[model samples]
Target: AQTVTQSQPEMSVQEAETVTLSCTYDTSESDYYLFWYKQPPSRQMILVIRQEAYKQQNATENRFSVNFQKAAKSFSLKISDSQLGDAAMYFCAYVGVGQFYFGTGTSLTVIP
Candidate 1:
């Protein structure tokens, strides 16, 4: 079984600043995929970044980057230059053996 955990239920960052959301997962599968998704009030899930377990390098998409520690099963997201639009509910997800698991989520607020 695989599960994702996000310790912080809510986070706040100043506009144009940076914020990091923490996530950890437990999985027995050797090969899998980890992802961070952002969902706004519209309830649309947007892919922020993804990382392959076999890959040693972390994944990055524009201002969104991940610090993936495969050995420790930690996949945290770093959001740089935060903007108003970045305020949303962030979910950490794990996909292994056709099974998908998502964290409870972390609500992010961008303060101007």
Candidate 2:
């Protein structure tokens, strides 16, 4: 069984600032993939970043990065230089053993 958890339901960051969204998972599978997805008002799920369980290095895409701790079952997303456009519902996901799990999601608000 695999499950993803996002402790923070809502977060706010000032424009041009940075914010980190926390995630944790419970899984017995040794090989898996973790991902962060952003869904704006349009309700489209956009892949923000991903981390492979076999990789020790965290994954980063543009101003987005992840801190993936396999041992601790932790995968967190950091958004740097946040813009108003970045405001959205962020979801943490896990794919393993042919199963997909998603967190409840964190709503990010960008303050001008």
TM-score of every candidate: 0.98, 0.98
List clashing residue pairs in candidate 2.
none
Write the residue-wise lDDT of candidate 2 on 1-112 in tens digits. 6789999999999999999999999988888999999999999999999899999999999999999998999999999999999999999999987777999999999999
Query: Which portions of model 1 show Cα errors greater than 4 Å?
Result: none
lDDT of 1 by residue, 30-96 (tens): 9999989999999999988899999998888999999999889999999999999999999999998
Query: Candidate 1 at residue 29, lDDT?
Result: 86
Candidate 1, RMSD to the unseen true structure? 0.6
Q: How close to the true structure is residue 69 of candidate 2, measured as C-alpha lDDT?
A: 90
